[model samples]
Target: MNFISFLLFSALYTCLASRLGDRTLPELSASGITTLITTPDPIKNVDPSNPASHLSKILIPRVSDTENNTIVRDYIVSTLKALQWHVEIDEFTDKTPIGTKRFRNIIATKDPTASRRVILAAHYDSKYSATYPDDQFVGATDSAAPCAMMLDVAEALNPLLDERKKRLDEGLEDDEDVADTTLQLVFFDGEEAFVVWTATDSIYGARHLADKWASTYLSPHGKRRLMGTQSTELTGIEHLILLDLLGAPQPSLRSYFLDTAWLFDALVSVERRLGESGAFAYGEEQGMAPEKWTTYFQPRTELKINMGYIGDDHVPFLERGVPVLHLIADPFPPVWHTLKDDATALDIPTMRRWNLMLRVLMSEYLHLRPEDAQPHSAVRRDASEL
Candidate 1:
């Protein structure tokens, strides 16, 4: 997609979506400084908060501080359980003659019986080192923000789930327009490569899952076409939405067209609609504006994403033919990866709004029954308050 298309699609929201662009997409706000991310409130033990708590996990002092896969897995499992989801720990030993690293993909499902699935995913593992300073960057924005957002959604969605189950049992017909999408929250490890910039180092977890998925649904056939309503204890998969470094001060959610189609459009449309509809930004603590973006992209409208191609966890699902949508944005965000990338750069209001947007979108697309949405909505906090 070209920059113009990105601008135009957004312009469609003449009053709310597009109007902000001209005013918001100015030259620059802050100097592009290399900074480190400060560690914020650590994940403390809260049994009533998340059933995933029963799994025995430790919220590392920092993201990069994660020394091994075990800590990361425990955190994923415990956090999801606290959200009250049946957990599936998918593992693949990357042991090859070239060598292998142990990787695990944590998937906690709140309503697996739902007809279809909508996945909310982000990488929990941190890059081992940084190129800028002696500090090992704690990826609060890169992945943590998205992760925390997912956690927040889990908390708030819990109550939504109960409502869905009741309606379904009462024989609510499809005509009544109930969402039956099963919600899957996945935390991927091995997303960061051993070598920082090497194409291989970037997205190990997503690629591995794609390869495994292709083998599962396509090997029997000539090619894999990621589709179907079929569900499994550990098989059948479909669409996915990937979240990355979105917690920056004012993340510009520029829709990217250079990659997958259905997925990206659905996500961007969901984000904008929710924003304009005010469901995502409801009862704002301070009425924070949408994330401000850079004017580097073309200003047009069409069915395409922004020219910004990102290296994030969504690439794998797209490769697997799952039509994954990526929330990767433009200008790489100022606090991308520097010792200056601390929590100080984080904005709780923006994070909370995004969490609400994701919850609503996931429910809309994934068929996450209103009830299932709740069983996991506790993850969202008052952004303005934070």
Candidate 2:
């Protein structure tokens, strides 16, 4: 009640408030703030044909073939591990038309500490045709090239990701709550149907993984939280970008969802810039026009056209409310699901263009800086960053 007592209480309250504010609003390190560089200039000199360059190593009879599944799985696992990524296998058995079949989803992450993720996915399975049981279909453009392209992107971004991880480990970055934007690569098995294209027959790995992720939760202490906890949310996935039928010549890619149209346009812009830099000229020998390198979903005319829904590996994620950017050819390549869809179906020039476009798009998305200037900073945790 005395004046001295009142002054003491006031001083204590002020000190407590100051400490709480310091804890909540800690000063961010300079390394934590990302600097946006010039957009899609194609200044970096990279091999244009790198995306399809791995086809020879990956092109196989059928990903679903019992004898070839392990080989394909081993290739994927070893490729990711060689890039220093943390890889995990999601193995499960599913009931199919033929019988009980085992499927595996190879999940790779660059940063394990980051809660939010950008998923780059492709199905590694080739279709099975009962009519041509003895035929060996390579499905090069259908999915083999797409899977290889995903690996190319992962390999390109590995250095930046490793640097960010180092900064986090050394305490050079002060962000604990909001880590950098991390990349998650998913190689789904059984995307192709054993019989007919039914809801249950295809995308077995994607369906299982999506369900599992939706039910899983992380606690504040980094432990597995209960599924029904009120505070739990789907914090792992931010955006899902699915690549398919990407190695065909003069392929057309259109924006699938209204939400991810901006991303599609971004890719178009990247293609245009790369064209200006003569990147697409590499395709001239193969009869691809450099002027037509842009994506099919141009804002002025093509934006209004709806290409309808596609049933790829992203279906389960999209159905569960996760944003998806389906990077598949609109009309389905001519050789799709045919015996002719082998290594010869892939166009080297088209693969080159796709490789450059993907590199620029990913660098822009992750705010990657030049290796000589400074190590790329972690993406800020703000919504605008997404």
Candidate 3:
């Protein structure tokens, strides 16, 4: 991600943020949050020391257009596919500063038949380096941990999503419109520029995907979001929550858009509940214990437009009028873009907290009942029906 002067584009972003309608997410029950956190073993996938973990698999020099990029893309695809998600690979070639290169963005939806979707996304590709050792930059906090946390959210909530589907099918769901919205995870490729950050050089996959979705018209049957008007894939999105620069300790996050401020506050609520419940107290990280943990989100003061915006994959989507919640570290970790951004830069307790936070946040966002989900089952299918 790159930084731009907030003064240069504050008005433009404020206008875009206002285009989004207000959204209210149901809060998960204490037991539900506990079930979601404990069942999936929140620390498993994000643990860098575990060779079989998702982070370990993704912690490599996966520069876009390279073999490592393909490997990481395939890994993400297979993981989502194992959970029976509808996965689509947006493959294309675009001109870069260096030359034309191939980019594939992974789009995984829990229920492709849903009318609308809320996206959780992060970039899977690492920064490109010209030298050998420099090329080994893994981008652990840059995005690898965020990607892993996305996977963890999927695993933790898959059963609850199934239960929600069952309720909807049985006509027992409270709100059909809310139940119609599904979860979609997007792993954007080429988010990192080949050279310095430039409008054309950065976020190649996002720019392409956003443009494609904007133009790809959906049939009237699925255009229920816009009062029977013709809608495109982009219009079917309720909100796009983009995660970046996570997995590091002591990092601060802020609400970048007025439209998603409620959603950001919703996430802060999840963290607060989990912290007070002692869920973040992992091993020796006593500071994260109940009443001792610090907040990742800064306090929201005046209810005004944001002062600036960060240049990331969400830019194209937000410019196209998508409600965006950009959850990126404000200060950029101390190891930003350096060779030191390997596994050493990631803190397990921090990643675990992120995992739990996503599980509860998404569970509440989707109105899923994690209380109905059981732990350790192959797919939580053996649990009592919702």
Candidate 4:
């Protein structure tokens, strides 16, 4: 079978197996199936010395500090640019509890010509902790790890994106349906509050950007244009997958929104297969067992799907009728917002597992063909670069 046909068959088999229980395909090896589906180079080459390596290394204390904030902002922009993505900085000053402070949101896009977009986002700012010393509070798992994972995903998919753009530019395909879906990465600023967590103090960048995008006019291909009578709606956002508190070991992620419950289950399945393949077995660290992981739509007794809401950057987009997949641990990690939330809190095994899971998820989501996975030059960098 051709690569695309093989992928479709695999997806169909997975859905069927998921619905009818693994008993239906009793002889099928879950890990084997996942390996067959994603036939390109796996994530075994993701080394510790790579550019997208440690999350704690990219952590900054707060976005309120101009110098530090610019440092973080430039790092994100340069990283995305290195990955060959179109980068933009949404710079603005907003009124907060501690008066007006400058905030910048880093937006990066692949396949900018595609009208429909799938967003992979994370808040880059560390929370302002009055209890801890200013220099001591580095939000590693709070969001730095998640941000690093997003960048890694973008880098992994760069080959497919470049191929799609090349075909479109050379007029190899005459149909408009051949256009690929865009992947947009957003690094939100000011998700943490200066003093107290209030509506006015938190999620400043998300609120501002959501409103701005909603009011602005864009052509069908996503290029910004003059505003007409009808403004661009939030419907162009196909799915917004927001990751948070992700570096800790063995996190139990549940679906928060009912609409995107399927996506959540797919990720859970990916995690399970990865575990069965011993993908989480990194050195001495024994990650979460397969049984410990949970899915949102499992056949249970009395658990609600959309139980409660955790306020984050996706709220503004969710309020505007955008479907969201929130990948956050229900019970916050042990070192949440504490002095220990530094590099000590991060588990290398857990980060490796997440990295593999996202790579597979994005490849499946975009329906990337095996031939499209072209080998790119290594992103060489020293530890002192960032």
Candidate 5:
């Protein structure tokens, strides 16, 4: 109320804002539907290729922590350790002058010595609260599904790779044991928009990784990558498979077209291979296929990949020139950002099926070669994007 008191308060507020870094949040109302609803092909097959029984069997408790980010970072770390992979918790030490939430990423690596690397990523943090129903927002299917599935796959693959290494030492001629790339599993933080949309409120974790990987790591092709352009900054990256909202009824792979075309192509192949089609047939008959599905037209401008981009941890990597494959649902899934976005919304069987699809694609991408190992398709293909 007094002049001196007002001046002092203003000065303190200015300092806090400066320290917080003027990151603008997106307008929540700006989040809109870009895709036309259409009848999607049904899915049929459901199988777990790796049979990581124990990994799938375990119950991972992920709670919403007010102090911590919504994601259970410790749970992710523990899962990685169980697989025997060396884990690193990359800490983000910056704190706003006023108050700030802690941020970090969990990295699980298998063979650091390998020249090539594969990064499988997912954001662990969920929305702050239910934006819809009168319930707590538990992101069981949105992300917890991806995280858990990746954990199972990692656990199964790590030991398999280790065994192959042993046989090679014995001169057992293990060509199949040869891996084309080292795998890195990163659990990201700060994906949700703080104020719900502007720009700076999204993608904190991925941006950091892009800068580090592009500058510090050498590509398998041995190109001087980021060091070539914007080396002092972050400008180089080739690929990324960012899993989000993967546990819906029959989730479709909808995202920025430029970066996700290859992944999209692969998904079609996987759907056929895994027999996800039958499910879609049922969907069609059940009238679950959206009303305005279009199979041939180019995605609309608003749908112009970037135009419809739902800002998340993936954007930062995309900004750094990483070709990020955002494996997310189309139309932003109705339950998104709502209180209904909880375990009750998850379809266990559907989640299991999607998990199989992911393993199939990742294995294809990994292209592992054992001295006498076998290559098997992870999918049964009967489902598709209607």
Candidate 6:
């Protein structure tokens, strides 16, 4: 992912963002959020110090087409597969400035048969460097951290997703269509440019996948709830939330598109609740205690804001009319594209906060009911406000 001039495409994105509809998601009750935060401990998988943790597994020099890349990709695949997700290794070859290179995009779906899905995506490949020391760049925050967080989210929410499915099976779910929407995690490869950042070089995996899915039509089935006349894989996506440049301290995220502004706000609300509830407080310092924690998201104002989108994997799908919520840090981290972007660059507390936030956010969006370890009495915040 590289930065390009946002002026030329601002109007186009503004139009697309305006045309897309916002989803009104059910907010999790306080107990439900607590259950998600503590059930399995959100920090377990993202801890950089834990050698067997997901983040530690992915923190390697995994440039596209390299052995390290395959190792990281396989780890992601095996982790999701262990949870019984339907995993697809989208392998392909694309011509690059260097030469023809292989790329594999991991597509893991919790329920592939579902008519529609909400996607969480990130590029798993690190930027390639020729020199020995430079070649060691792991891109810890660039995406490794985000990938680990996705795994944590999957592990934390898998049971709740199962429960939602059981409820739908028993006809206890109020909205069958919404209940049918599944969670899909996409780990795109070949996101970095081989040479200079160009239209043909950057985001090779995303471009290929988007074009393929756009043309590949889905066959009709009785279980498909709202199939349009020409329903394709691309069309089946409810939204694509892409994570990039995360896992760093003091990262500032903003709403990049109007279509997903409400969705972004929903995430902000989750963070606020978690922060105020002291869910972010960790370690002996207790740095993220209720009053001490700061927000990662920049609040959206009533005034129309059109900050042109950053050039990333989501650009391909966004161009194809997919609603996107890009959760990338603005003003790229200081260690970005440097050898310093290793395990040390990642802040475990920040990653833990992200893990908790995703668990609560995705849980509520999917209408998942987490079994409360300790029940609390409070009014439900499931009212559709967005």
On TM-score, the candidate that comes out on top is 3
Instruction: Judging by lDDT, tell me the better candidate of 4 and 5.
Output: 4
| TM-score per candidate, chains pooled | 0.65, 0.76, 0.93, 0.79, 0.64, 0.91
Report the lDDT tens digits of candidate 2 across residue range 1-386.
00011111222122212211211122122232112122222222122334323565567765564667676777777767766678999899999998898888889988765656778889887777676558777788778888877776776666656666677778876654335468888988889888887889888999999888867756654532222343223445656899888787777766656556667767777666666545566523624355644454435245343334667888777666666778888677888888888767877667766766676677666555434235432221211222
Candidate no. 3 TM-score: 0.93
Model 1, 245-351: lDDT tens digits are 76665555555543234444454554554444333332444354344322212333454344335667765554333445567556566766655554565665566
Error of 1 at 167 (Å): 2.3
By lDDT rank, best first, the candidates go 3, 6, 4, 2, 1, 5
Select the stronger candidate by TM-score from 2 and 4: 4
Q: Write down the worst ten-residue block by lDDT for model 4.
A: 1-10
Per-residue alpha-carbon lDDT of model 4 for 1-386, expressed as tens digits?
00011111122122212221211111224543344234333332323344445353466565555566676777777767777678888888899887898888888998666666779999888877555454556787878788878877776667766776777789874545335457899999888888877778788999989888878765454442212335364545767899988877767766665567667767766666766665555555543445543332233122545555678888788776667788886578888867788767876667767887887777566555434345455363432463
CA RMSD of all predictions: 11.5, 14.6, 4.0, 9.4, 13.7, 6.5
lDDT to native, each model: 0.50, 0.64, 0.85, 0.66, 0.49, 0.83
**Local error of candidate 2 at 272, Å?**
1.3
Q: List, residue by residue over 1-386, the lDDT tens digit for candidate 5.
A: 00011111122122212221222222111111000001011121112222332222222223223433432565556556655577887667433222465667788878655443557888776655333234445565556667766665674355446655565568774343243355778877655544544344555566666666646644334423223323322222235677777665655555464445645566555545444233222332433233422121133343344444555666556554455666677645567666666556665556544554555555555543322334322221111211
TM-score of 4: 0.79
Candidate 4 stretches greater than 4 Å from native:
1-57, 130-135, 167-180, 220-233, 286-302, 380-386
Ten consecutive residues with minimal summed lDDT in candidate 3? Answer: 377-386
Total clashing pairs in model 5: 48
- For model 3, how does the per-residue alpha-carbon lDDT over 262-289 read when each residue is reduced to its tens digit? 9988998888889998999999889999
Q: Which model is ahead, 2 or 5, in terms of TM-score?
A: 2
Name the regions of candidate 1 deviating beyond 4 angstroms: 1-69, 95-99, 130-134, 175-180, 217-238, 258-308, 366-386
Tell me the TM-score of model 5: 0.64
